[model samples]
Target: MTEPRICSDDYGILTSARDWLAAGREPALVTVLKTWGSSPRPPGSLLVMCRDAGHAGSVSGGCVEADLLERYRSGELGELPTRVDYGVNREEATRFGLPCGGRLELLVEALTDAAQLDELLAAMDAHRLLAREVDPASGRVRLRPAGPEPTFACGESGVTRVFGPAWRMLLIGAGHLSQYVSRLALMLDFDVIVCDPREEYARDWQVPGTRLVTLMPDDAVAAYTGHPRSIVLALTHDPKLDDLALLDALVSDAFYVGAIGSRRNCELRRRRLRDMGLPESQLQRLYAPVGLPIGSHTPPEIAVSILAEITALRNAAAPSAGARSITAA
Candidate 1:
């Protein structure tokens, strides 16, 4: 409510809030309580703001951001837990940059302490999923282990928000495609790890915020086996690398295992994996020709397609690459 500042990194918001609070600045945390129609961000999205106008994370993609910033700067938002709705009318929609008839509601809280944020960040650092509940009405706060990403609630005890382990992406190759994929994945909050045993490819590999490993793709896959949020993608297009990683990953608890290939090659790979005694069920789980069929032809475009499919799978919005639909799961 003080001064609205917003960025797009979900994981960085808590850290930013911690820093702002430590700096003796007024930090306000805003969450997308609900939405209607074509909203840029979905429910549970966060926008952490400070009195100095510094922001981390986003509630809306853009238009609404400017309005929030202006409102906050004008001190129109009083110092209290408040609810705000945007785009209720046609003019408001246009002014706030919402799509036709789009609407969203937000809950704003001026946080006083960083203790809970410290705990949440610690849990995430330890690779533990935790739900931090805040009772703005009573100032009672608590943190507890979280289950599979749940649809959080906002009620009498206030809001229960999930602060989970970073999503993991294992890229099997260090080529151009993997380079683009890794960069984009990091922006999406994926803890990216690239495995390419070829020394030639490894030498010049330099993508900040991503870890590179020189090992057989299968060996890399083994290390990530049973990871709940892991999405393994083989972009090398070499059978030795892609097939081996796919074999190991498909059998693991990894939610999404994918490989880049042509449509015809996808069928061939399926047959080969089938001959390797990989069952039909597990084979079905494989996302061959990995990515949504987006008519992608360049490395960056291909990277987007891949991430799009991964996002879909992460939300169970569609059946991985086996199907494609824009609707929510």
Candidate 2:
């Protein structure tokens, strides 16, 4: 899988892009178009350092900043856009101290057209993935659909794809545990939705910014059409509700589908799902014993474990990927 792209706007790159766009002068956008060997960030990592606005995005692990800063100070990048390669050999790697001999290729594009920059920003704000191509020799910019094309922009500079939006979470229960989970989800920038059909539960739900709904759990999951970016957790522990919701969630695109239950109950639930025509692979996606094995015995403690696991999944830094890969029950 391709490493996800970072938004120029998200990492405070908007300020630099805006300043250059406002000045009616082209500014250099230095992006770590590709990387090999040990690197802090993946491909598409960016540094939109402009002539006037300074720097955005980290290309190297603080090793290249001094040189980049010097280049910025000397106006070496102002002439036009350029492609620069760093860490060619052992000596160069030692000079830069790239930590594990990492080599990075940077594509610098002179963004002269404010309209194009504005369009890129708007597309990102709207949660669209964009592939930006620049001419290595001429520094011309072109926006194309994000995918594998031998070459885009008609043999221009290499392509850098920018991915937008954080992941989303939907909680099927708005109970005590849901409160803590929702709070942490917001802090993690996940768009959260809480669903509960019980009037009392929905009425008593008081967490701010969480989308509260009284829809049936199964219908709510169906309506959501959970995607790879979505996570659904059935914390109600009520089979009548959670079972159906879990059934819907397992068949959807949700990357994580979990429920709060004991080992025995989880086994029963799995058997029922398997009997309902769910494939063994699909059934395996159910994280019945949700969260990590932190021996969490309380609602708030369980919430912390759940949030930690979710964060690991989101960052792709988890020791193991997949729903049942980590179980605390």
Candidate 3:
């Protein structure tokens, strides 16, 4: 098994906030409520700062965090939740390390309820999706089941940000391509699990920060919980292993299912799976000959193309702005 991964999610920050509050220390929780133009971090990014000068997570590269820390320490940010904006103009954007023309609006709240933080963390631990809503005027926080997708919204009424597990990627093979794919996925904040049952392949699979499962591909898929936030990539290029995983992933709710192969091989694999009883609708969900048409041939280039396509599809599927419904209270 590979070494444990550094969790690439906000849960670590939330956990730290809970611990600090439980120790009778008041900390400030800053959330990026909105962004315009070329912001460094997206809306829903988190930053938690303790009065003792410790901090976790980030809303910007570094400058914004420095300013936020100063304000937090100087008591400018009080117990009540308030909105703070940075990089409203080009000069400010440069000063704050945001891209030119970038703008960020933040919600800063003093955390006093360890119970609430614990409850939110509990939901996440149980694999339950949740949305946290904060009222600026009254400093009230509410938690409820989140929608099928993650989202963030803010207006005069308050701020609502969905919190859920980190996205996951399950690779069906531990080949050379799998190594590159796994490394790239980790950098993108995905929990990567690789399944390769062959003793020869599994023995030398030494990618830190990834989990290696020896179970058969189909059983690995079954145990992985193909939730909507999951990605399944069959990189084995072997019909015996890759096909077994595809049969399971195609029928599941995993947001992205892909297989790396030549166009001809992909079509052949498609027919093979279809003949094995996978419906046309589910088969249509498969991204065969996976990756964008970037003409990639090398392992590293192919890995980049694969992740690029996944990123494009994921963003394309995000809820429309109208669904989040920004409004002033």
Q: Among these predicted structures, which one has the highest lDDT?
A: 3
Query: What's the alpha carbon RMSD for model 2?
Result: 6.0
Question: Comparing 2 and 3 by lDDT, which wins?
Answer: 3
- Backbone clash count, each prediction separately: 1, 1, 0
Enumerate residue pairs that collide in model 2: 134-157
For residues 1-329, write the lDDT of model 2, one tens digit per residue. 12223323343565566775686544556667667787666655667665544676677877776677677668775566666767878677778867577887777666667777666666555544466666567656677655322211323434645444345677988899999999988887676889999998899999886778788998888765365556899999888888889888988877788888888888888888878888877777777678877899998899998988877766567754443433432
TM-score comparison, 1 vs 2, better candidate: 1
The TM-score, computed over Cα atoms with residue i paired to residue i, of candidate 2 is 0.71
Report lDDT (Cα) of residue 47, candidate 1: 88
Task: Tell me model 1's lDDT, rounded to 2 decimals.
Answer: 0.78
- Residue 317 lDDT in candidate 3: 48
- lDDT values of the candidates? 0.78, 0.70, 0.82
Give TM-scores for every candidate, taking all chains together and pairing residue i with residue i.
0.78, 0.71, 0.88
Q: What is the lDDT of candidate 3?
A: 0.82
lDDT pick, better of 1 and 3: 3
Task: Write the residue-wise lDDT of candidate 3 on 1-329 in tens digits.
Answer: 23333365678998999998888667888999888998889888899997767889999889999888888877877655888999888988888888868999988888988878888787666655688889977888998887566567878788888776678899999999999999999899888999999999999998898899999998988877477778999998899999999999888878788888887888889889989999877777788777777889999999998898788777774332222111100
Candidate with better TM-score, 1 vs 3:
3
